[model samples]
Target: MTITEPVPTGPATTLPGALSLRAEKQPDETAYVYLRDGEEPDGSLTYRQLEADARSRAAALAAAGLGGGSAVLLYPSGLEFVRALLGCMYARVAGAPVQVPRRATGLARLRRIAEDAGTTTVLTTAEVKHDLEERFGDHPDLAGLTLVDTGALPRAEWTGGFPEPEDIALLQYTSGSTGDPKGVMVTHANFLANVAETEELWPVGPDGVVVSWLPLFHDMGMLFGVLMPLSSGMPAYLMAPDAFVRSPGRWLAAIDRFRGTHAAAPSFAYELCVKAQEEGKVAPGLDLSSWRVAANGAEPVRWRAIRSFAETFAAAGFRPEASCPGYGLAENTLKATGSRLGEEPPVLWVDSVALRADRVELSAPGEGAQPLVGSGVPVLDSVVRIVEPASRTVLAEREVGEIWVSGPCVAAGYHGRPQESEETFRATIAGQEEAGRFLRTGDLGFVHDGELFVTGRLKDVIIRQGRNFYPQDIELSAETSAPGLHPNAAAAFSVDDGERERLVVVVEADGRALRTTPLDELEARIRTAVHEGQRLDVDEVVVVRRGFLPRTTSGKVQRRACRARYLNGELKAAAAAERSAR
Candidate 1:
């Protein structure tokens, strides 16, 4: 169904303004609760406390002449990042939340982001500042940065007016799964619009509580863990991403503890939780009855993950309808489409052969069918159109093509990237020029029965003999082909062998399995599976130890990077393969 323009939720223009209103309305209400190690509460902030802390930081930022400029917020996941971000809003400084570098590659990425934003100021905690200073001698690029400890900022009253609606509030950097990261300029208006659209779609009740372990630097985490809860006047319980990674059960325990009504993660997270339960990692007799929405986004929504999670958690009071698959990107300010609340996510089985032929044909569950989970319809006030990338012509329903979106929720553009911003954010639809510019999302999807079914990324499509083959299909086949392959740790791409493109599948194998199973036998299994499943010959199969494959900060496999490493012979194959090569 078509979504019309959404009604304004409130008079608050900026995020700071919304927080102030909430503080005035309910000063004693808890705004945020930080979980230390994802188990015990470390600290909690009331609305009054949060507003005061943010104002104090804002005053300090203004006094430091940071207004109208961007500052990198380099902090671990905690309440400090939240306060600093809100302070930036109050002081009219665009906050760029970046993940703290932990390695050489991470430090390089940090330098690139800092250089791209043209910012010298970094707002971080005292501990982080000291650590960076100690390491600055090794990395000269980071040595020149001016780090300000937000905790040391004096507690002064902020008198400055809130930023305007169109003012840039954040410089959200892309995950760079495909390429270099680009900072999307999300304005105050874009933030509010997206939050409003989310509320309209999800409609959080007064008793709603948000429990999240998503990284604050990522778009989904920022919106769901912070902005959405604040906008909805709900309390949020947040924990560091590492905590959740260490034990997926911590996330569920937090939900049970806080009676959390809303939570979101990628499809892999749900799979992890299912695995954790199967391995008896989750606490016994845990009641997740309070979880109203289990949003799965930021990656491909897998039907296997959805079904497995529902069945595994059914005894814990987790309803099947709580699985809400969604589609979004940083360019759209977070959410583009979400499954309707309190409804089972739609799943469609299609003929795999027809899908390769760029056609959607209904098929029953069988050997040649693929199950696709719907990511729901366009959110309120947003317009989604499927367009043929080559001709830029809108496609009919169920016809797979590039997804284009238009709405106020769309970010202003990429920061300092005029040409790329213009090309990506300002595209006119063929024969519909009057409708205005649309953001060309490089994703492939189609609308079937008014529900969006994301197929794959347009750039990741592998063309062989004039037919399109999606990498995800091949990756799925490869993962199931071998018994020891790590789930979602496979990258499938094509390499040019001078004459034609040859298919190569690079996968991560369990270390224990590599020791127990023969390398040749494992490779044979994968090759046989791909040949049987997709009827495509595998040119090469590279197996490496778990966590060796290249991945984005958000945990998405970087196929291009993997392909480059394979060609450069930089990838160190598993022990067995290495020994076999010798």
Candidate 2:
């Protein structure tokens, strides 16, 4: 399953310049479909038209005194936003896209990203104009910067031109919901290689139409929804995230309406679709038979979510083989591993206890508390291996270790922050960090029968009583043990109190439901479950309101934010106090 085979469709055309290689293959095909407010819910642009628009925007940016190697920040996702990114490519300028937060507190995230990049020229939209102006307008580092509005940009200014493949095309910033976001430097060559590899691994035929609600700022959305379709000569059906959040049914409806055959999303998205189905929100008689590839990646993939989604949507003709779950990161240009075009879901069940103890022991269903989905074998030309955390020695099959990856898919390295880059990007073979450099994924997992299975995170592993426990396992147990707890709402982490580590379980409570229940019963239920199911002695079980969980725009829970609130005495430890009163 190592990535060494040529793409079934064959190599891309010899492009004279970067961004042109893929564009040359499909000049008249639709590249992007944008959803906007007050206007038509969707807009489409062909490869030729998008290229022209990008060139015009690039010329305008060049006229504004920006040129090759200059870094610009892109904030919004739409047809115009895509045009601006293309403009950067046409002008030989590099641009980074950051995740724009919907709330005010998210401004701090943007500021942190700006500080990390040390740039000022930002591409924004009218909706976020005031917020950006107020939050970052007066900053010294951003002086003399231009904040271009994608919606208001004049289309008459751009004229089609081309840039070199060696020229820097984009700088997509990582969604540092975990830590500081780094600007990943990508050239036109990187995009071509990745797109070629993706097409190789999962071929999209001429009739294929892509539909996606994933944000364009994100790597998967931009690469697959916007870039790959153009390269593959396919149309994309796009809707806004708000549209899908408001009515997930619309996502399926669009697929039915457009006959979309290709799409991608995180694991939670499928879970949301399943919830929407349970609420009877899915339109009747809608068909998804045309959906040949529904890629699941970008974050941790849960087996429960995948199976639930497949079962719920079976009546809609969504094939089990169509649901592809895999692995990747922004550093690898969005895709690393995924199911073949028409294969059943790849999965592996492992013993929950031995998995926590540096052992990659497999188990049958119902024998373990958790079963992780396999992210599939490496894509064409990519390599995946598991290495021991301390020694970096390559472990054999079914040996739990830190995942190390190499191949053409790995990005060059992070932009700036050399020391941090060295630590993360350098690979260790035979006890040396510099032995052979591969992207240190910081993820804990192993290979079984040549398939990659990610259990959880290495840093997120909670150590207590000389035993390693995965927070994901404890979190899942709490959600299953309690009727009211929201799935994935609970976070379990270990904190030190001058001695051994103490296990802290934080679950968002159904505030109204808790208020009605007898306090004794609620506390008893939580305490019993933590001790019995997880086999961990908990010092505290803090429960907040139902809507208390902090999340990134991509819907990932912000555990650090929860920990911060718990430490500051903002969250009530109702369960913990109830147990003490006994």
Best by lDDT: 1
Rate residue 407 of model 1 by lDDT. 94
Model 1 error, position 64 (Å): 1.0
For each candidate, what is the lDDT? 0.87, 0.71
Per-prediction tally of clashes: 0, 4
After superposition of all CA atoms, the RMSD between model 1 and the true structure is 4.4
Model 2 spans with C-alpha error above 4 angstroms = 1-28, 36-40, 71-74, 130-145, 151-166, 177-179, 431-435, 481-484, 509-527, 530-532, 568-582
Candidate 2 per-residue lDDT, tens place, 1-582, comes to 111223224444312243354455666766766655312456778777776666666667777767665555555656776777777776777777766655445555565566666666677777677776776677653456566775566554544345555555677777645356687766666777778777776888868888888777778888877778766667776667777767777888888888889888877678778877887888899899888888888456888888897788888888888878778887777777776778886677667678768786667877454577888878667778888878868898888888887776677677787787777776667755564578888888888777888877878888766678877767766766565666667878777778767778777666554766665565567667777766777777776666666665465666666676667766655445634544
- Can you list the residue pairs that collide in candidate 1? none
